[model samples]
Target: MELKDVDLNLLLVFHQLLMERRVSVVAEKLGLSQPAVSNALKRLRLLLGDELFQRTSKGMEPTPYANQLAEPIAYALSTIHSSLNDKQSFDPLTSNRKFTLGVTDIGEIYFLPRLMVLLATVAPNVTISSVRNTAVNLRDEMETGHVDLAIGLLPQLKAGFFQRRLFHQQYVCMFRAGHALDKAEMTVDEFCAADHVVVVAAGTGHADMDATIERKGIKRKVKLTVPHYVAVGHIIGSTDMITSVPERFARACVQPFKLRYVPHPVVRTPIDINVFWHAKYHRDPGNQWLRSLIFEHFSDQADAAA
Candidate 1:
């Protein structure tokens, strides 16, 4: 189909459907009647010659064709919106922008509290939402504008993505303050023999700490495997199990619960946490302001720690 023959507004409707995954919700978001949204979806399907979405128990799942169209449609819409608003300045103080971020449980522990405080003081109208970072298709999620930013040790990032290193954190061995192992500095042998709680998120590989131990020809026995770091702390507190966590998080956990950090016997490779965004947003004024704010907040944190 020719570009002139298709309604450009249909693309906007298609984008909303892709993001919300439900026609009724998309209609509510766009302030259009449900029938209007359904009509637009039908037009989009005809123009694209594909059933863009298939009804699923969870929601409307995107077809392969719809997935392929997501990025270019989002880019086009963003470009059009930016061009139309070229004369208007982005006033963060008055603007209510919702930013969705993909972050790991460890990131939520180390960064969210301070970040929220900063936002409260500077951009009170801005809102933030965070989802777990899995070892899945993050590049697609970023490119399609599903997630505004991702914060973590992303091992493999695709091209055309911009990344800024936030900070490097080392792992520390943590145990209850009066635990038997807390009497001395933790040795690799002792760490491997201790009953451990391993935290593993979906799609993320098996525990990096365990992998490090295995490389030393020692096997670390995991007494339990939990989905998030938040649960790991609770389990460690109630039981005699030890867990290796990022130093910043371990420090925070040590304060409330009677916990102590013993130096990790294995070589601790500092995990580099970085913020990543699509290159298309690199020079956008709103995006630039948000990125700067994140860096400033994290920089202050590093200084305080030092």
Candidate 2:
């Protein structure tokens, strides 16, 4: 089929369907009636001579053919969008786009304060929405343009993603200011003997809080287990349990939660914290501007290495 036979406008609907995997969502995103979106899909199906997507209990599951076309089509559309908007410079002061960011709870605590302060003056009209990085299908959300960017130690954002290092953070032992382990130094044995709060920081890929301890035949007395780092400062402050947290995060909680920290005995390589975005929108002007803003205010790769 020649390009003339195809309604390129249908590609927009097609792309939205591929990302959303639901007819209603694609319609809403494209500002069309569900039947109009369905009609576009039908036309594309006829032209391509294949069922691009089919309804299933798990939403619109893409055909192998549809999956095959996803990348090239996305690249083409992004290029066209870039060209069309090339002359219209992104003015942060006047643009009111809402950028959705994917972040863990700990990330929200560590990154948002400084980010919002900078945005308040620079892009007062712009808005920010946040989704849990651990939420279902976050990668697909980011790829589809639902979630614009993510920041953290997410290992899953590898392929089809672009990332820049913000900083490297090592694990530190955090506890109440008056806890028993509040001392000049802590040995591995004392660290093991103390009651621990096992933080299952689910999407950061560092949830195995005991891997290093178990490597040395050390068994920890886990007094409590929690799914997030948001309440760690509060819980550890009011209890005798000590926990391991990222160094910067610990520093942030120090004064607010009346916490103290010492070097963690387990001694592992530092984890990199980075800002991540889908390669599909890497060149989009607004995305570019926000990422630059993040890098400018938060990135400390050079200082961390030094």
Candidate 3:
């Protein structure tokens, strides 16, 4: 089809239909009457030469052709919408935007509380969702707009992605208050020999603390392995087990759980916490505003902590 002959508005209707999977819902989302949306669907079917959607008991289901066209069509509509909506300034206080962020448990503990406080003050209408960062297809997720931003110690991120250093975190040893280990600083042998609770997420390897210990030609005994760091504090508070985690996280977790923190004899290597996004969104105005807000919040927090 020639570009001049094609009605681009039909693509918007097609995208809404694919997203909602129901004509009625798509019509409501686009603020168009059902018959108007149906007419647009008919035009899309003729333009694409395929039945884009078929009625089923589950609702409107996309045909194979529609499935193939979904991403490209949605991406095109997004680009056009962004271009037309590009303004010199963004009023976050009045905007109701939802941002999806990819972050690790450590980040959720160390950064999100302060970030939320900042958002509450600056953009109360803005919503935030945090997804777990595991060993998965991060590059594809960011490229396809599945996630708006990722925060973690991402070492092997793909090229063409933007990464900004948020802060460097160091390791600390955590145990229940009044525990024997908390009486004094922990030696390497004591740290290795202590009954330890290891936190490992699904699809992720051993914890970073383990890797740091291994490099010193010493091996630590992992008495238990759990999926999240939140669980480690619970187990450590009840048992004689100790865990090594980021100092910021340890500080946050200890006060609530009545736990104590001790300095480890081993040299603490700093973990780089970074904010990553696709290069496609590098120039997007809304995205730029959000990124600036995150940096400002974290920078202020770091300065206060120092």
lDDT of 2 by residue, 1-306 (tens): 788887888999889999999999998898999999999999999989899998999899989999999999999999999998776468999999999999888889988898888888999999999999887588899989999999988888899999998888788889999888899778888888999998877656666545665776878899999988888999999999998888989989999999999988885668888899999998889999999998877778444544
Task: Answer with 1 or 3, whichever has the higher lDDT.
Answer: 1
By lDDT, rank the candidates, best first: 2, 1, 3
Candidate 1 vs. true structure, TM-score: 0.67
Predict model 2's lDDT versus the native.
0.87
For model 3, the stretches where C-alpha displacement exceeds 4 angstroms are 1-89, 201-206, 304-306
Tens-place lDDT digits, model 1, residues 53-170: 9999878899998999999999999999999888645778887988878888877887788888888888899999888778446788878877888887776665888998887777
lDDT of 3 by residue, 236-274 (tens): 888999987777788788777899987766747777777
Q: Look at candidate 3 and tell me the lDDT of residue 181.
A: 87
Q: Residue 240 in candidate 2 has what lDDT?
A: 90
Alpha-carbon RMSD of each model: 17.6, 16.7, 15.0
Clashing pairs in 2: none
